[model samples]
Structures are given as C-alpha cells and as structure tokens.
Target: MLPRFLERLRQQADNLAGLLGNRVALFGIELQEESERLLGHLALLLGAAICTLFCLLSAVVAGLVLAARYGVLLEVCATLAVLFLLLALGLAWYLRRRLADAPEPFEATRQEFERDRLALNGARETAQ
Candidate 1:
C-alpha cells in the first residue's frame, strides 16, 4: 500500500509539472504575439503620421497661397489652426477611450488559470 501511494504521488507530481510547463509555454506564446502586434501597430502609426504630416503641410500651404490671392490668408490660417486643434483634441480623447477599453493582455492565460483553479477546487471537494 505504501509503495502504491508513493507511485501515485509521483504520477501526480509529474502531471503537475507538465501542466505548469504547458501554462508557461502558453504564456510565452501570448507575450510574443502581443509584442509583435504592438510593434506592427507602432510602425504603421509612425508611417501614417509621417505621411499625414507632409500631406497636411502641403495642403495648408496650398490653401494659404490661394487665400493670399483673395486677400484672406490670415483668416484662413486662423480658421484652419482652430479646426486642426479641435480635431487633435477629439482624436486624443478617442485614443484614450480606446486604450481604456482595450482587452486585457494574456486573456487566454488568465482564463486557463481560472479553469484550472475551478477544476482543482472541484477535485478537492470530491476528495473530501
């Protein structure tokens, strides 16, 4: 009986180790995926920002030149400046909202942990 108990104990330990290893691997995979996604988003945002900067500058210059021809360059500039500022503020708020609502990282891992906890608790209740 003692020998049988020892063997069962060893099997349980091995099973626990395997479960831990799998969880670790899952976590690593999720972390890597998250990092890759972040880097890709950053790269795209940077490119978009650069393109938008040049586009806005060119457009403003063109608009200003046209307004100068009509003797309303200063007024056009002031209006555009205010419009851009308001747009920037609105976008900033939207970005903050998006970030605040972003899903938790490692969501799968967290779910897995919860499932494991529940299963372990069930097992304990049954054993009792």
Candidate 2:
C-alpha cells in the first residue's frame, strides 16, 4: 500500500511539474509578443517623429534665412523650437530607459510562492 501511494504521489508531482512548465512557456511567449509589439510601436513612432523633425527643421532654417533677408525676427522662434524639441526627446529617452529597467511581471514572485507552498506542505506532512 505504501509503495502504491508513493508511486501515485510521484505521478502527481510529475503532473504538477508539467503544468508549471506549460504555464512558464505560455508566459514567456506572451512576454515575447508584448515586447515585440511595444518595440515595434516605439520604432515606428521614433521613425515618424524623426522624419517630422527633419521636415520641420528644414522649414525653420528656410524661414530663418527668409526672415533675415526680409529683415524679420523669427531666428529666436526657430532657436526656441529646436531647443524645446531636443528637451522633449531627452525626457522621452530617459523615460524609456527607466521603463526598460523595471522587472518582469509576477514571474519570480510566482516561482517563489510555489517553492514556499511546497516547502510548507512538506513540512506539515513531516510534522504529522
């Protein structure tokens, strides 16, 4: 009877391990897909922003030249626009770096919880 019970327990342990393994694989796939989507979005937005910035900068330079020729005062505006855009880009880069440093969601925590629970149960069984 004890041998049969031990065999059944081993089977259950194997099943539990299989379930956790599947969960981990699924979570990894989900994480990979999310990361890819976020990176793709960032890439596209960065590309569009860079293109728009180049166009705006060209326009500003042209305007500055035209203003100088016509004796107007838009050099200050052009300078301010460039400065503000650079400041915004710097802030965005800083934010992206900070977000990248954040930990993955609940993965380590889940593993720890599983370990703790298994240990507690084993202890309880031994005590009994």
Candidate 3:
C-alpha cells in the first residue's frame, strides 16, 4: 500500500510539473509578443516624429520665401508641406489609438491560470 501510494504521489508530482511548465511557456510566449508589439509601436512613433520634423523644416519661412520667388512653386510647396504634416499627425493619432486599445499584458496566461484555479477548486469541492 505504501509503495502504491508513493508511486501515485510521484505521478501527481510529474503531472503538476508538466502543468506548470506549460503555463510558464505560455507566459514566455505572451511576453515575447508584447515586446514585439511595443517595438512596432516605437517604430511607428519614430517614423511619425521624423516625418513631422522633416515636413516642419520645409514649412519654415526660408523655404516659403525661396518657393515664393518661383511663383507656382510656392503653392505646390505649401500644399505638399501641409499634406505631409497631416499624414504625420494621422500616424501619431493611429499609434495613440492602438496603444490605448492594446490588451493587458499576460492576459492569456492569467486566463489560463484562472481556469486552472477554478478546475482545482471544483475538484477539491467534489472530493470533499
């Protein structure tokens, strides 16, 4: 009886270890995904800022004066500057919206753990 009990205990320990390993793996995957998402967001932000700065420099008085000396060139330059700036602004707004809408970190891991907890509790209650 003692030997059988020890064998069952070892099997249960192995099962628990496997379950923990799976959860840990899920956590690692989620963390990696979140980091990738953040990196993408940062790239978008950098792109927008660079676009804004480049366009803003062209919208300066010196640029306008130089374009103005060319008559039709002034209107074209002004329009393009405005368009680029608007595009940059739109990108920034999009990034902001995406950041705000991002899901909580470790969400899947938390959910899985919650399910595990509920199952364990249910089993305990039934056993009682």
**Top TM-score: which candidate number?**
1
Model 2 C-alpha lDDT per residue in residues 25-112, reported as the tens digit of each score: 7677768866886797678668867986797778777777777788775765757678768867975897588568756655654675
C-alpha lDDT of residue 77 in model 1: 95
TM-score, one value per model:
0.81, 0.59, 0.73
Which residue pairs in candidate 2 collide?
none
Residue-level lDDT for 34 in candidate 3: 94
Q: What does candidate 2 score on TM?
A: 0.59
Ranked candidates, highest TM-score first: 1, 3, 2
Total clashes for model 1: 0
Preferred candidate (lDDT higher): 2 or 3: 3
Superposed model 1: Cα runs more than 4 Å off: 86-103
Q: What is the TM-score of candidate 1?
A: 0.81
- After aligning candidate 2 to the native by TM-score, how far in Å is the CA of 42 from where it should be? 2.2
Q: How many backbone clashes does candidate 3 have?
A: 0
Candidate 1 residue pairs in clash (backbone atoms < 3 Å):
none
Extract clashing residue pairs from model 3. none
